[model samples]
Target: MRRLRPEPLTPEAFAPFGTVIEADPASAIGINAGFTTRFHALAEVEVEGGAPILSIFRGRPRPLVIDMLERHPSGTQAFVPLGGRPWLAVCAQAPGAPLRAFLARGDQGAQYARGAWHFPLLTLAAQDFLVVDRAAPERNVELADLAEPAQVALDG
Candidate 1:
């Protein structure tokens, strides 16, 4: 097994794989008497020919181990945390390419581009998330098993 430590999530570092959705009052359009701020169009959502589906996912914390990776070739997938808890994201350029790990806070979210290989949701604590993706009739997942699993580590 290989050990890997995740780096802090930033818009620049995550740009290659997808967009980093963050709330910035400076970049937001104020509405409702300036009481609320909205960061609009934070991600490039692609659904191909399928319809977009909104779903909620509750994930339990688990050890960071990448035994396999999966990808969606038909559409882009986004995950936003509903609860204020930090999480981890692992992604790669392709099925067998080198992997990169990112640490995201509760307020941050990510949208992965089509065909980008990634691991499933990972959290240090249990958390709920809003997931948006394409709903297609055919299978859209492409999975690959790694010969050597990658163990994820986090630093303060």
Candidate 2:
């Protein structure tokens, strides 16, 4: 197995995938103070293997972080960290706008940006992640003629 650590997470880097964990106003914010929130079930493409494969970090102590992969004239994306060490695996497709990744130590994955590309939540040990995304009759996808790639790393 190989050790994969991408450069600082960025929307341009995560263009191939959709936004990862996003904001949830309903989910429990803490032990007792939380508002209504939403949940992700992994970004789907309505077909068998039509989406990107959930790549596993294959390492231990995965570090998860609360980062934002934003897209500007490129697209939107999310950086979901898996495992204890906090490794991130984004699940997104076709970026259309510019995005930014705001990752931190105490942050959790949240909602998908409007027109922002995103991915499913990936666990370091597991090659599977539950994601939240949007796919309607009208799909939002884009290609970067001259795009750059970003990597996600958590300080967990």
Candidate 3:
């Protein structure tokens, strides 16, 4: 098997899945810093369900990686990144069609496109993050056990 050196996370590359999870400060107001706002509503994007749409995705800081992988016994696999800066990575699928990544300076939170592949979560200097993405729920669902516990990473 080949190992992918972590690249910058982008929605273009992770399009096979879903939208990259991003947190707009303007949308963040009363969120508890020490608390988690559980996701009760099935947070989802209905538009990009057919084609791929990869781009920047961000979210809040949590100690764990989100459920962003589906066992699509068929089709391609997608991956995103999770960190406080601009970063891109091909976490799951084979890198090709030429993949690219980048991160904004001083950003924050952990992100995972519904089924986007990504390195668990990273806080190089602080609890900030960005997530790469992709998804195909119809093909598979996350199980109590890691369906594919792959080790994801990055450098620089």
The candidate that wins on lDDT is 1
TM-score of every model versus the real structure: 0.94, 0.31, 0.32
lDDT of 3 at 155: 38
- Model 2: how far residue 39 lies from native, Å: 11
What C-alpha RMSD separates each model from the true structure? 1.3, 10.2, 11.1
Report, for every candidate in turn, its global Cα lDDT versus the true structure: 0.87, 0.36, 0.36
Please write out the lDDT profile of model 2 over residues 1-156, one tens digit for every residue: 112233333434543443334344443244324553335343332322133223322333334432333322222333344332333444333532333333322134333444544323434454323333333344445434314344444333
**Cα lDDT tens digits for candidate 3, 17-68:** 3344445443454446747553332224322344334554344344323224
Query: Residue 97 of model 2: what lDDT?
Result: 36
Cα lDDT of model 1 by residue, 1-156, tens digit: 787889888999998888887896557887899998888778877988789899999989987889899989999999999898889889988766788999999899998888888998888788898999999889888899987789997754
The deviation in Å at residue 141 for candidate 3 is 9.2
Clash totals for all models, in order?
Answer: 0, 59, 36
Q: Local error of candidate 1 at 155, Å?
A: 4.9
